[model samples]
Target chain A: MRTHHVTCDDDVKLLAALASNRDAGFEPLVGAYQRRVYGLALRLSASPQDAEEIAQDTFVRAYRALAGYGNDQIRALALRAWLYRIALNVFHNRVRVRRVPTSPLELDDGDGPAFRIEDGDPRTRPEQTLIASETERELAALIAALPPHLRVALVLRHVEGLGYAEIATLLDAPVGTVKAHVHRGAKLLRASLEAHNREEAKVEALL
Target chain B: MTTTNRTPRTPRTPRAPATPPDASLAEVRALLGRLRALADVDAPAALLSAVLGELGLDAADRYFSLRTPVGQIFVAFNDRGLSAVMRGESAADFERAAHALLGRAVHPATEPPARLVAALERSLRGEGKPVLRFDLRGLSEFEQAVLLKALEIPRGEVRPYAWIAREIGRPRAVRAVGTALAHNPIPIFIPCHRVVLSDGTLGRYSMGGDQIKRAILAAEGAAPDVLEELARAGIRYYGSDTTHIFCFPTCGHAHRISAAHIQHFASEAEARAAGYRPCNVCRPALGA
Candidate 1:
């Protein structure tokens, strides 16, 4: 999920076109929000394939909903918060049926992007890349394995940098409680990171 | 200090970055930053079209305006087949009406070209192969049956609402049959104008009233004056004196019957009493 800059004014333009003319500006809307929506799904689901499916479904549902809105109603929307809410619902609904448990292996593509960059760059230090990749992968896997409520809140808070207000709207929880849960989740994450680092020191002693 | 120090292995936290923006520890910030950066995957190049395909938007409902016997009209279709044909004041009006009816957007047709009009005109005149496929998707099963049966009326010929109702095996739905034909989305191509009142009068047409219906029928070689005359004379069925078969006045077999050999019956009972059976070709009603 590449960071996309779908400005509010741009969204208003797209919404105005879509509202006045059914389906107009839809492709561009998808273009603008696809990265953020896909990124949100990928983090929530921890699988690239499920992320793509969820992203596509989210946009499809958005299209159906936006078609019925008048210009002003559509223009007033905060697209990121709204789209993230839809993506969250799509992810949960899929999980309710598929019952896929989040395990460490699912985070293989969650953070470590070295496999793709290996062939693309020649100046890269393979040893340095390997160490960095291992660290990020371990951290991502830890985040992915968090309890659902904590994982979602923490990711929305720290990983995605969404404010508490938007996070509340997405998770449908009150702001104060969500902040506490995210802080508790962050503590658990730090403890896990420290424990994993201690294990690495023990392993290195043998080498 | 030297005796207490152990040889160092590879650094444990290779992910320490320039600065942790938040007050969170370096590893936590790095992990979240990487996740945020991965969002730049650009959503795979194929995803936009895949989303459109899922929303049923990739398959464009292509339409084009054309001039015909009835004047300018809109023809809309999709990969399924022709969905609508009607008159509109402008292309925008046509597009809006199509959206309201089909619940999807329509775009201008890029294919089908100028030759499409000629082929359809020939098909309507019974001179070309039956290449036109009517997309009657939104119609009910009964309405689809009614329209498809109406399609078999043979270009210049006419049938009654009751003929369609009976043909579709819903004899009591004669008025419903009229309603279906009246609301035929693809009018000229579906040829709803061919279905008239059982009394042989030109029925109301949703396209542009009876005058457009009469003109289109005239173009297809069904004479309006003859239909009017039959309506005035109260003739509901035409029979061949030699074949002893009765049909709707517009049936091809009845039209072929010579003036001297033609027989007109005011009612199906009269035709039955005269020993004439309903024509197998037109499949006229056996009961009242």
Candidate 2:
């Protein structure tokens, strides 16, 4: 998702206003975190409608919980980690109620090269722009198709640029486990992309 | 021999070779960066309002419109309950007045909550007694007392302003009672329409003109035509042959009397002279 970078200063201002029960603090807080929160939700749920509900619910729940906090409590809070935790909880609750499994990676069991390099860089050649766009789309699909637990760790680590310790804190897991999930998730993603490329080459040969 | 063996052991050690970085790992990192840059959609514009509404914050001091037989009635409310009910006023005018009265900004809701709509409908239909709560924040103690006394007037019945003033133990404040009714923030629910002039004429109402007031009274089984006829003819009292009780012309029982069995008296003295006692219901002896 398009990342709208939130500055540290903005978080400080938002937290201060929220601590004092000021209404003006609400808009800025929403603007600062909406994109990242929405992005994380969309990646988790893979449904725009579900993502919207989750995002709205996350902000609402945060607002209510913050309302009861004293100034000191709000000041000491880590807003991003707290918000992500809330969003994750909301997503898990929804998944539990729906009783549907997270989207699984569509790949056959096969061994392939760890990486493949095309002869020419697509961005350098306008003739290969369409192929490059297709590859990007495929990459997004592969990410979305990761198992829920691994996807969460991978997204937090790579997409959100979060460190393993931070992800462990957010997920309430041990740091070692978080690191392993990210590692295995990346390996599986690479394998699935390789398999997909092989199928595409086979189709081209037949054509 | 020991020195030669030590020298040979020292020469046998070699440094371990360094491993190179995987190009595949770099490609995967680049793909993740692209995914992070993908455009995500924003939440719906109404979502913030909806969230506030769900939390009961936006509704704290808001106006909601309801369709009624008279017209669209706008009722402003807060957490306490209904603050004001209005009609025919522009939204801006209503907002200004509500802000002055409630000391908070008032926004117009597309429609009121379902339970409120049902309560209003039942009140309008004059169905079973429905208890309605009100904010009445800006009203004075005397005004609140007058309005609360007016609530005692049953549906399909009208009372004189003096009756409300007397009921509130402020008999000399009859004009003040009128003023309070004129400023009633909640009209239909509190039922200011059930109050009339001492002369039995339907009084001016704040919600709409007197015509709307008359219609509301008629809907409640109070016959405006009969009351108007009696007022025009200067009839102060009516004697019912069935009950042998003379009552004020606006009395519910008095309105039922057939012309053949009806006797009109210009004054309570005339009715008493005719051997008719004052009806306990309307008490014509009290006189308007």
| Top-DockQ candidate index | 1
lDDT of 1 by residue, B75-186 (tens): 8987667888879759899999998888777888776566667767677567966788777767899989998998888877888888888888898999999888888988
Query: Candidate 2 on A1-207: residue-level lDDT in tens?
Result: 344567788788888987776455665676678767877887676555567788889988988888787889988889899999999999888878977654533433345322231222333347655456446545656766777787788778876778778999999997667766776666667667767778778755756
Share of native interface contacts recovered by each model: 0.44, 0.20
Report the TM-score of the second chain of model 1 against its true counterpart.
Answer: 0.79
RMSD of 2: 15.2
**Compared with the true structure, what per-residue lDDT tens digits does model 2 show for residues B1-288?**
000001222222232111124434456457566755543334545556555666555546768777787887778876678888887547888888778766767887666678877878998898877667888756899999988888877787777888787678788899999999998888888889988877777879887798989888888888889877767887767898677799766677877899999998887778877888987776546543
lDDT of 1 at B217: 89
TM-score of each: 0.55, 0.46
Per-model DockQ against the true two-chain complex: 0.18, 0.12
